[model samples]
Target: MAQVDRQQWDVVVVGAGGAGLRAAIEARERGARTAVVCKSLFGKAHTVMAEGGIAASMGNVNGHDNWQVHFRDTMRGGKFLGQWRMAELHAREAPDRVWELETWGALFDRTPDGRISQRNFGGHEYPRLAHVGDRTGLELIRTLQQKATALQQEDFAAYGDHEARLKVFQECTVTRVLKDGGRVAGAFCYERESGRFFVLEAPAVVLATGGIGKSFKTTSNSWEYTGDGHALALLAGAPLLNMEFVQFHPTGMVWPPSVKGILVTESVRGDGGVLRNSDGRRFMFDYVPDVFKDKYAQTEDEADRWYEDPDGNRRPPELLPRDEVARAINAEVKAGRGSPHGGVFLDVSTRMSPERVKRRLPSMYHQFKELADVDITAEPMEVGPTCHYVMGGVAVDSETAAAEGVPGLFAAGEVAGGMHGSNRLGGNSLSDLLVFGRRAGLHAAALAAAPGPRPRVSPEQVDAAAAEALAPFHAREGAENPYTLHQELQSAMNDLVGIIRREDEMAEALRRLASLRERAARAGVEGHRQFNPGWHLALDLRNMLLVSECVARAALERTESRGGHTREDCPAMERAWRPVNLLCRPVEPPPADPAADRIRLERVRTEPIRPDLLALFEKEELVKYLAEEELPE
Candidate 1:
């Protein structure tokens, strides 16, 4: 066996997205030697692909908008399954974070008054997203990257060496979180370009790796989102919460096969785009669920009028939350109301003027024109649902972002669950990456600073991890292609357990996932490890299959339709299911109990909502789901 490079640090952060970068910065600020490791270039993490904006109660657009309203909207958008404390903190702290970004050189679009301008997004009570035209995410990542880089330069000068207080290890993939006893001691990582192993030994580790979107066929998430953090945490004995709640964002490009699942930003709808069926009828009015009744206009006249006078008229149904719109699109296509591309029409051409559409959403204009050869300023574009985000992740404390049952291990960003609950609203995701990312960094740094002996990784564990990583190359004859298995898994997830699921279909998905997992273990690849895409997929297949099982099992267990999870047989939102959060954990493989294998999923009733927060809602609303004993004054 080759010798693995070993390096020690106070903290190791897996992932280099908005969350991981923020965490690394905070960790370094707290005097911990930190490293941010990622599978791509520093600025190319999925954060840059976010086209909407970050949510914050800056009150630049509407004076009535405040943290409380933002908090309520976030809870409602998530269908109230999110952790109350995290939501509260995110709503309250987000404005400050956004403002701080401006100081760090985030040049956001401004109102006439020179205050940070905000934009409209689905489920937000007021226009609450702080943006930079259509490229808010790019500006955000740029600012953070510049700030972190400046700090890194300062550290390099101070140390008079290449090593800095905060370092970024780009194009590195972490395969395992090394554990010492019950606590995380470090992680096992490999450079993507070289495929050479490196053991990063740190007292504290933060898993900020994003989501599990690649489990499905049509996803907007990058290839890096193969459930690295989810699987790493689970293998380290941490539980994942609400694994079934996956968000399929509406309005992905559907015309061109090459760009089928590519995201078409919600900014189009926020900027006055409309959804129409093949007959040129506005169809969103017919699909509004009862839970969202009275919030959206039901008639074309009212919907059009609402766009001009949102204060007086109900908002248009086109501005409904992503989950609602995605399901509506699915239903329309099923009912033969789809366009030539098997999707509904998103028409901004009829609403916004050509100049306005081009100016406000240059990316969307270019994306459509270049990808599908459609001019959004002149015609409607074909759009449908795409697997966007997973609402479930490593279960963590709302305050600390500490992984359950795993000491010295924490998570944030999309990897940490219980923030968005059943479905995340637009703009909330960016705020989540900041609010919780900072918390995880601060807490992980503190954990590293605590008075104790530094955690250490055992040589035996290192050898085992290395052997496991190398097993795909040493497989005997008759091995299968990792890509083939990945395609099969994606087909299973897309066909059976997608946006609309059924009892029998989900059960079949579980059986298929089990078979895939078994087969993935025998995934083999040719050639050496260096820059080998096949070898990488062979490893990622394990994580995807494991996370897919978690999703399939939890979807089967949760009998009610809520938020992103819709069961055709169980369509109504059952109030009784509101307080329960299904928790997923993997037992030892091939257990004596068949049910005790990779995914031992079970429900854990969530802690009752805090009394003070519960008091914010109306009495009528509280009684709908909460018991008298659970409600507070």
Candidate 2:
């Protein structure tokens, strides 16, 4: 391996998604020279594809809604397993962040009174989502991109304000995080377009690389969400918490192979969509328990009445939390009420006017028209669950977004754990990116400002990372195809550990993952580094393997169902199970480079809940909120 060109930055953020961009902006504002690195174009990051609105306590739709209620709802939603501090911070700061975005030129939809509009979503006590129809993510990305560009121009005019200008490294893939002694020093990356290696030296590094949804065969996540940050943190000995709690969005398009698993935004439900099977029966009514039974109208007449009167007696069908709705859909399919396409119908045309649908869901309308050739305003959308967000990630303090036990490294957004706990509420993820991403940035920038002696990146460490990166290219005798292995991994995860899980199947999934890991060692690559899908897949496979293993292991350790990690074998929530979190750390290789042992698992202590909040967990208030909320549609 040749010596790569080296550049020093005060802060290096690996990812240009919502979290990364926010972090870069905050760091620049805090007087740190920041660089944003990503594997794709800046605006093309997966954040652009987010369809739902952002969650914030703007109190625009309801005066009763406030941060305290939001905080309480979030805690309950996560089954009391979420870090209370992070949840508190998210609720407190989210409203301000949303307003900040508006100041930055984001044009959110307005309510009847002209305040930022709020909509109902799963697990919220009141309507709190601020949105722009359904294409909230696209609007957000475009606004941030424009802001970044403007900041760049302003910095150029000032010339000496190096901190104001952010250096963006596009098409750069980080292979490994380089540590000096015990702390993170820098990172090793390869430029995809030029096929040249670059060593980025920074005192502070932020990993915002997003979720591990691609580990499943069917997912709503984009190709870039391969869990790179999760793998990188794990390899660097950071503890990953709650790996078992993966969220499955209930309404992914199931028909038409070309558009398979595309997300059907929850806002459709929030706007009055009814989920029905071929039998035309509302199944959630039967599945809902006493907890949610009263909150929603029991009959179709009541549902319609609720729609007619916004503050009426019935809860809309669209307001059901994702888990409850997903389970309901699964039950319908199992009961042989599925449509010909193996999905249930999400019908909104009956409640919403065609013009209203088009105005509110332009992107959704366009997507269905171009991809599935269906007019959503006239027809029912066929939908089912698809792997979406991971609610669990690296354990971090809520205030700082700093990974516990790791110094000089920070995490934010989906990569950092403890905000959502067992499940994430709709519209909360974008807000999380803004609030926590900025916190991580401010903290990292502060550290970077007080300059100490620069840490050294050893030649040996660079060689090892380069060898691992180039192994697939040099393996001429290997028969294992990286793409096939990835497919197999995805299939196994989808079958065994997805939606509802069982012990026997989860064990089998683990066995399959171990086999895939062996094959990944000999995975082959045929094309050059530039624009090579095969090579990119090969590299991404490693991250997928680490994430899959962690998730499988964490699922196995938890013997009770809570939040997203549902186990058919253990059908009930166990209060005793709340004490410990399943923490995973990479096993150190033995001296003389012996084969690495299985990753070690340790049980970390979850902060004890206050006595006052115990009833929320014991009584399962969050679960009730999910089961009963009146969705808008």
Candidate 3:
């Protein structure tokens, strides 16, 4: 076997998505030589697909919106499972981050008062999302990409100064993290184009490798979101938290089978789109909780009235939380009120002007025009739930984004757990990437400032990883297609462990995942290593298996339905449930005990809510009561 060469670096960041790019930039600014490794092209990371705006309490559209409100909304939205400190930091810092993006040439929509526009979203009490029309993620990625490009230019101009350098290795897939005496040293990577292995030795390593949504068959997440960071951290002995709580976006395009699961941005609803059944009846009014009952209009007359007088009446039917909307759509489809593709309708034409719709939702219009041959301005779009984001990930501290129990290993963005908790509100993820990404970079750079000698990379470890990576190519057995297995995994997840779950279905999902894991061991590839889709899928399959097991096992352990882990068997949320977090650690394969082979689950400690925070919930209830009493007809 040919051995690959190795190199040393001050800091190595994996997964060049929004979080990785942001962290790399910050690390460079902090005077550390930083290298970014990604499996795909830099600009093509999954962050580009996020269409909804970034949530920030900018107080642009509504004076009532503020950081406190944003914080409270985030906590409630996550069902209080989120770390209060992280939520607090995210809420407070998000406004400045969004504004910082503006300074870097991001052109967001303007409010009537000429400030960055804020719009209403599910779980937010007031309009607080800072947006660039509808393709906010695109604008964000473009701006950040440009900024990183500029930084690279500046770094080159600095004449080989390590402090200002940022080295990006595109299409380089990290196979395993290298550890030194219980600390993360660096990682072993394989360059896709050259099919050559390399070692990056550093004092600090950051994993910003997004979510595990590819585990599910029908999802809004991109092909690259294979839960790499989650698996890597688990393999490196870091605990993963809340792995069961997966957020399914309420509206995804449900026609043209190829694009069936593409996310139909939440901004559609925020901009006055209404979800309806075949009979043209709005269904969300009947499903909302008492907290939002007074705030939501039931009748079409009331909805139209609320639309016309935004602040004078209740909120329109479209702005319900994702969970509520998903459940409503499920009921609608089950009751035989669905469209041809087994989805309900999202109609925006009734509420917004065609010109306004086109301007605010260019992507939505373009997607429909290019893919479905349907125009959003003329007809209702078929929509349903699609697995989008993971609320669970490698357990980490709110401040440092450093993985708990794992020294020298840090995580940020979708990979690091505990920010969103049980459910994430729309637009919060972008803010999460920026806030935690920067924190991880700063923290890692500070740790690197001591300049410990580079740890040695084990040739044996690299060889083992390389063998596993290349095993697919050498398989001579009957063709075992990775894509087919991936589809099966996704289907199983979507059907059994989806928006709603029951104990039996979750158990079945676990069984299916175990079978998939066994099959993945024999999975085959029929192509060379360079840009081989088969090889990529095979690598991603391992991640999907680990993540799926984590999610399924966590779901079965939690007896109550709360937020995204809705269990039909335990239909109601138990007060005793109280934000119980499941921590996952990978168990090495041995003389397999059938029972023990299952995901080993353990509950983690959660600090009691402060009296002041508990008081706020009480105050919110009182406000809800008063609003109910003063309800408008």
Candidate 4:
């Protein structure tokens, strides 16, 4: 091969975020040697950018809140396109996951009786998010990292080396999932700083790389989220489930231009903020759809009363699911009711005292004061939709977290589809990380520990990955700039295939994507690989282009408006489309020319919802989302 340095482990994890760390912890505990690789510093994964709280049906805040209600809320939030089993599993197990964090030294904000205090969030029937001010994600990452270190400490005591069982490789990126025939063998990776290529040969690999938000112009994602995991899975012969469902969070910063698209946490709304238009109208009241009308307050008086007496009044329309709220903001902006910066106003100043605002949303308070020179406790902030989470990802078995058609590959968190369906409810993401991350690790460890010959890492595949990585450095004449190509790609996706969609716009998006893919082949970087950001971006462009094609292609094929995916031409939520999932699988023998279509889209029927689970919802409610054949007699 190319004299690449190689290390062997039982399980190799391709991310170091909350899910990756949790998976590593589970794998090591199951007596497997584990390694975690990430593109950022150990604790700096996009998980830290998650500002709200972890969703779990603990019922600490409201005794009536239980798994059934949470499950129903999840399915409804996804517009009933979510995989029912995954929703059931997440609802049932999330409370234990949250409580487990406490056992591992997580200090969550507590209630009067000293229980983990849960707060209200969009799409939930009750107060169900376990939080630590507005920085719950940071605390979750800290807790998982501590748990991993504690295991390492135990390993050091017995084996005389801290890294004897589990180790984390920070500032490293996995470019390929190496395979022997059809089964996973390991991963091909590169250290970002030294530009050195290496391989981690293992029987099993868990992909926990977050999402593909960076493919859009205005996004809440960090630079590292260039859809590496999604691309890796697709190239390795695993299909991505429904790449069309992209979430544009309703409250990204819209002013000062420099800080545009930075996330303003949903905690702002969950903790008392309200959305208003330029006319100083609480416009959310005017936008509630038929499905959610019964659950939300109809008037300002009722909405305000629900904050203190949630049992007596329905939640404010401001707490509607993210897809609904994002579309509402877009509507307000389009109608010329937008703020000076082209977004609606999100205000908390009139709702709470300054001290309470600072106490409940410390990170948000500081974020606005320092970044935008605006004190959130004194005035409303300019906010709009920005591309955030992707609901589509690697298709996997609901129980084992194992990717279908790929023997030893598994995925969890935002990289795995079907859990959130069409749109994820606020706060469900952190709990999803804990619940399924553990499942993937347990199953991956079991597979690695099986008594059988290990899959051999192919040298030919390793060499090919190395060649592809190096191609950007050696460019032909008239090569394109990586930065400029990336800008154009982001613009195309944001304008054509974003929060709302149409047949012609998405078709045009696919054409632009194909051209971008051709130019991306010639993407050139000026500097040497060592610590060169341009070189890094050039490598990242391949992944972005591949995933962008999946998004554009699948978005055009699925012709209905549901949750995060809104088709303007086909604006109604079609019950007939509820049972279908659109999968993006890579074309066999990928086209030799980069300009040719490389992804093939297929339609797969979703597994039927269990009868027992279906009974939880009122038949009248089920009729709205299910086809006549799917409904119970």
Candidate 5:
């Protein structure tokens, strides 16, 4: 075997997005040496794709807004299937996290009163999203990255080495999380620039590698979201929670084919945009479900008045939770009321003046004009549902962010499960990243500082990882092409286990996935490892296939529809299924049969909501989602 580079750190954060950067900062501040590994260039992680804003209960725009209201709204948005403790923690801490960012030099757009400005988003009770125009995520990354740099500068003054306390290993991908006995030891990684292998030896490894959207054909996610963290956790024996729930955002680019799945930020509707069908009808009003009828306005007059007097009028139907809105858009298109590109019209041109549109949504304006040649100020954009987020992820402790069943391993951001439950609200994602990212970092640092011997990284595991990564280069003639295998996997996942799912389709998806798994084993590349994207993709196929199978299997196991997992055969949300979380665990050892299942699905009951948290919602509202036993007697 060739010699491999080796480095030692107290904490290894396997990503550099909002969560990863935040975690690294916390770990370094607590006096632990940290290393941040990312697949893209530093500061270019998928968090930059988040455009709407960060959801926090700062109450700058609405005095009625608070952590309690935010908590209730989050539970309702997830249809009460979320981890109650995680949601509570997120709502309670999000405000402090946002304020902390400001102290770290984040400059947010402000209200006339000079407070951080907040904006409306789907499923929120008030204007709770703190933002800087439509590019809040970019601003967030800028602030956090600068903060990390400042920490390095301070370390340089103290230790005479900038990277003595914290360092970033950019453009690197982790193939495996190496373990000693039952605890996390480190990670096996390869640099994308040179394809050189190395080991980052650490007691604590934080997985913040974001979502699994790239497995589907039409997704707002970038190439990096191949379920890397989720698969790594599963392979290391941590179960994935609620893998069936996947969020398809209500609005994504639908025209010109080239940019079909690019995100159309939810800020448009939050700022008075409406969803209209071909007949120019405000179709959302007619599609509001019984559960949300009282909350959303029925008449256009009431809906329009909500902008000026939110206290006196119900919110517009367009502002319903993303799941409802996405399903509505899907229904409209299926009913033949779709736009020329097989989507519905999202019009802000008629509602807001051109100046306001440009001032508020500069990114959306440029995105459409540059990508699809559409002028949004004068015309409505053709938009439809796109696979945006996966609520299922590595199951972790709500308080510590430590991955269950894996000592010294932690997870946060989109990679950690139980925070958002089945469906996440539009702006909650950024806040979730901040709140839990900090917790994960704090606990991981503490674990690293514990009095004990460090876990050992086994040479056998490193050799196996290297051999697996190199297998694609040694394939025989007539081997399956990695690109074709990827496309087939995407098509299968998108067509069968997409927004709307059924038992038969999902079962067939499992069948197709089995065959793909067999062929993916023989997936080959035509080039050497150095700067070889083909080789990288062939390696990524393993994670993609694993996560996709988890989705199909869990989607099939759960019979009822709720949040992102909608079943046509079982359309109604069953109260019985609300408290039962489906956990996906990898099948132990190796199976000889090619068609054998790789992941075993287990149903675990969720913790009962605390008494005080239960008191936040009215009994009548709770009756809609909770089972008879779950509600207070």
Candidate 6:
């Protein structure tokens, strides 16, 4: 048996991204003995890779913009499938979160009048994103990290030791959420450097572990985004809501095979870029959906005027919600109007000067220059769809951010569902991490401080968890290779259950997933546990496969084409399907076989919207796109 190092804390936060760091700062400041565990080194999380901006209705640029309008746009962008309370709370609190970040020393771009400047993004009615050039996400993470570090220093001043109390376990991967008598007791994790096991016992566990984009072949998400928190919460007995909704961003780089699928920030379009075909004609006008047909401009001249005078001219079709734009790009590529690199052309030069393009989108300019050998300020770039984020995850309370079925377990950020509904707005993620992450931390600290005995883990449970971690190294000979299984899984998800979907293909995907699950169990690894990539992937596969099962199962069940989930058979959004959400649950095996465990899914109907929210929208706005569900007597 592997030696296990045991420790105790008031709260344990999983993941070290913007959400985790923000949660940790809140928990530690509230006097909880907090610890953060992550799969990568501190400050290297995917949060730092975000480049567009943070969404908030601060009303800095446009006086008419406020939380109500932000709330309405969010619900519309989500296809009205969003949880009313979460969306409401997010819009209401996001502005404060941004201002708080500024107070903590985040340097955002300022307007000519010296207020924090806001920029335009798709699905937003006005300029609503607070940015720092094209590196807004970087500033968010850097500022959050600084604040957390400052809190650790305060802990040191008061307690004389921060390392033993408020700590960060970097380069560590948590495999399971340990429970004691039906409540979250702690987490079981292993360090990547030494392959040593550790047991972190905390009364409360907050899962801030980002999204599931890494499950697909072409993704902007990094390796650590393999749905750890989503899988952990599910296995620990929490239902994942709306597992079918996965967003494919419209403009990932398509040329240079090595850099394919890397994110081309939405700031390009937000800063007046346009999409065109090889025939030198703008194509977004031909792809506007009925829900937004009257709102978007149909001609290039109108679109150009809308950038400067949005109230007078309609919004541009190029600025449609991500799902609509991604589908249009895919259709154009399939219709043989694509560039030589199997994509359409995204150009900013025709509208903005070279100096302004470089000044506004410095990272994007450098990214294209260094990776593709293309100068974006002077020319267009080849772009296509790439899997970006999952809008489904562990279902949590709208107010408390507590996992619905699991006690003492909280979730926030992309790991928790309902905030974004079916499709998320581009800049909403950073703001979400701040808004809900604080709530989860605040609630978790109070729960840990409540009158209850400290949870304990038995030796038998520790031994079992340790044994499971080591099984991949001792499997029978001729077992499958972890790398091969991973590639096959990614390929299946991309080809069968990608941006566009068909009933027959998704059903076949489930069969392949079942087979893949079986093969994954028998997959083995060689070499010592020290820094072995194969061993790491072997364990991560268990999580990736289960998450894939949830996604495929939900995709097969949802018939309507709405937001991120599109079904060719159904073709259009169905009113009947609008009021329900698909939830994924686990079916533990009767014989205690991990390999035989199956993921079961069912649709749970959503509650009717609040009367106040219904009043915010005009009747014409929801005539076909979304209508309030009828209340039962």
The pairs that clash in candidate 6 are none
Off by over 4 Å in 2: 160-164, 312-314, 590-597, 610-633
Name the better of 2 and 4 by TM-score.
4
Q: Report the candidate with higher lDDT, 5 versus 6.
A: 5
Model 3 has a clash total of 2
Which tens-of-lDDT digit does each residue in 189-222 have in candidate 5?
9999888999999999999999999899999999
The global C-alpha lDDT for each of the candidates, from Candidate 1 onward, is: 0.89, 0.83, 0.83, 0.92, 0.92, 0.89
> For model 3, how does the per-residue alpha-carbon lDDT over 440-469 read when each residue is reduced to its tens digit?
999999888875676666677777888888
lDDT of 4 by residue, 280-327 (tens): 999999999887778999999989889878665389999999999999
lDDT of the structure predicted as candidate 1:
0.89
Least accurate stretch of 10 residues (summed lDDT) in model 5?
A: 304-313
- In model 4, state the lDDT of residue 74: 94
Error of 3 at 434 (Å): 0.9
Q: Can you write out model 2's per-residue Cα lDDT over 487-539, one digit (the tens) per residue?
A: 89999999999999999999898888877887787888887777777887888
Candidate 1 C-alpha error for residue 505, in Å = 0.7
Ranking by lDDT: 5, 4, 6, 1, 2, 3
TM-score of 2: 0.94
Error of 3 at 364 (Å): 0.9
Error of 6 at 28 (Å): 0.9
lDDT by residue (tens digit), candidate 6, 472-529: 9998978999999999999999999999999999988888888888888899988898
TM-score of each: 0.97, 0.94, 0.94, 0.99, 0.99, 0.98
| Candidate 5 displacement at residue 211 in angstroms | 0.3
